[model samples]
Target: MTTNPERTIPPTTAGERAMLESWLDFHRETLARKCVGLDDKRLREASAPPSALTLLGLVRHMAEVERHWFRRVLAGEQEAGRIYYDEADKDGDFRVSESDTWEEAHATWQAEIARARENAAGRSLDDLSAGGHRDIESFNLRWIYVHMIEEYARHNGHADLIRERIDGATGF
Candidate 1:
């Protein structure tokens, strides 16, 4: 299938939330672009040696992350279960299988991204989550956006290397 071209993130943007969301969306598109045109086998290929990081794994992980922060935390859904992974196998999302397909992963990721956007639609950056994970007692929407941007930025670096290793594709 022909993959869509990556959307450009404006170098200069107005407003704090716009800038944050734009960068986050750019990084999200970058990760998707990295996986574009690759089949399930290519998506599940592990990086060199000990790391189990794969393009598909990254997509799954991000879906969980988006859900966790937006739906669970921000929306105050403490009972929400994970889309991937469990207490028995916390890293299950990163553990690929022959049965796992790119279509499934991509669809889940897109759905979670949409849910996250919807959950944050009318919320203000100054709005705080009902609760926070672990040491963080509470978190504001602004913090979540910034954290997600950082998370994507770091993972996109890994994605860049893995994509190149897979097919010599480079640059965003």
Candidate 2:
């Protein structure tokens, strides 16, 4: 059965920034809802053979993504570093270990999301990122929001499939 009906629905019409943030928030809630009632082991369950994707891992990965775009790129904190991954094992976030508890991961992800909001607050959509990453130079808040929406939407799809596989739950 579905869960978490409290997710905010994006308005049919709204200002540009409001629309983007709303959609992003909706997708964020969708991902979290996919994991509802699932235990840590279940949350870490892979999709199938040869695929290590998990809901908890997705949460962690998104945490890293939020930190990178907001704090490191937009806020220009080069030394902020990564939360769950590094040079050797870029997919470490997805490599959910036994030590990684769902509660802790969720809290960390939420913290990153909050910081993302704080960093973007009072900033114009046209404002370029204080720094840039490999290949690209900089991205405006608009671009970051759009990219984050896309990222979450794509992962929510994966989350749907994984949640379905776990206990035949679907269409949350």
The residue pairs in collision within model 2 are: none
> Where does model 1 exceed 4 Å of error?
none
The estimated TM-scores of all candidates read 0.95, 0.96
**Which regions of candidate 2 deviate over 4 angstroms?**
1-5
lDDT of 2: 0.91
lDDT of 1: 0.88
Winning model by lDDT: 2
> Evaluated with TM-score, which candidate comes out highest?
2
Clashes of 2: 0
Clash-forming residue pairs, model 1: none
Instruction: Give the per-residue lDDT digits (tens) of candidate 2, residues 1-172.
Output: 1256369799988999899989989988888889888888899899987999998999999999999999999999998899999999999999998778888998999999999999999999999999898989899999999999999999999999999999998987
